[model samples]
Target: MKYFIYAVITIVGIAVIAGFFIVGSPGLQRLRRLDETRISDLQSIQSEVIFYWQSKEKLPAKLEDLTDQVRGYKAPSDPETNLSYEYEIKGEKTFALCANFSLSLGPEGNNAAIPIPARGYSKPGFAEVNWNWEHTEGRSCFERTIDADYFPLIKDQKTP
Candidate 1:
């Protein structure tokens, strides 16, 4: 039954190839999901800080300063690690936010995601303050600055 043996080997080979993809996809998907969550968490924190600056005319001393019972907003933490995101005030108008990312922002060895635009703040002189969200595997941080002259424009818009 040489033909039967060959058929069995062919089926087994096909099954093995299929199995690899089926088993491997979930792990990759989970990593991508975690990366998306990390991006979302950073965006949330950025918005809160911008809102705080607009309302108070100064940067919050720490991330906790954005927590307010009246607004029902609480600082977000890492989705997979359950650790608090990193924050540091570099200047009166500058701050940095950091997170541990599980995957590269794009294909390997390519910094395709550099200079991600800071959504919602579009004033002419204030354009430079938009934070960059580019990152690689492991820990990455984004720097931001607030131009106080545009604070009035921020006030006119509702908190996102």
Candidate 2:
């Protein structure tokens, strides 16, 4: 009887540990899914921008242009947060895309890079998570390289 009791206790303890791990596993997995979705959404926006620029001469001043005016498309927000993504207009040819400031869950504010797939005019690029205006070398404060012919979609209007 004593051996039976000890075995039962061991089983309960093991079950508790297993339960914790099992419950915790999904949280980690959810975070990874969120990150990937955010990255993929950003990449999709970049590709859409490339497509828009190809059909037109400049990038839309805002994201809604895709949903409202552009044909066969609409901008997608993050699935987890349901918030519109943010885009920084750097110049006539380059821009930066990110989740809204509040959507970033990273402690150090470094979001992952959207992989630049070798298709269409969308080249892979990275973004910093802050608004620091410093001109650090190799650490673009708010600048990006726009190399493709479709890059001009992001250009801002110049006043005469």
**Model 1 lDDT on a 0 to 1 scale:** 0.77
Q: Give one digit per residue, the lDDT tens place, for model 1 in 81-124.
A: 89899999999889999998877774452334333344565656
By TM-score, the best candidate is: 1
- Candidate 1 C-alpha error for residue 26, in Å: 0.7
Query: Tell me, what's the RMSD of every candidate?
Result: 5.2, 9.5
Residue pairs whose backbone atoms clash in candidate 2 = 58-153, 59-153, 92-155
lDDT of each: 0.77, 0.56
Candidate 2, run of 10 with poorest lDDT? 132-141
Per-candidate clash tally: 0, 3
Off by over 4 Å in 1: 1-24, 107-118, 122-131, 153-160
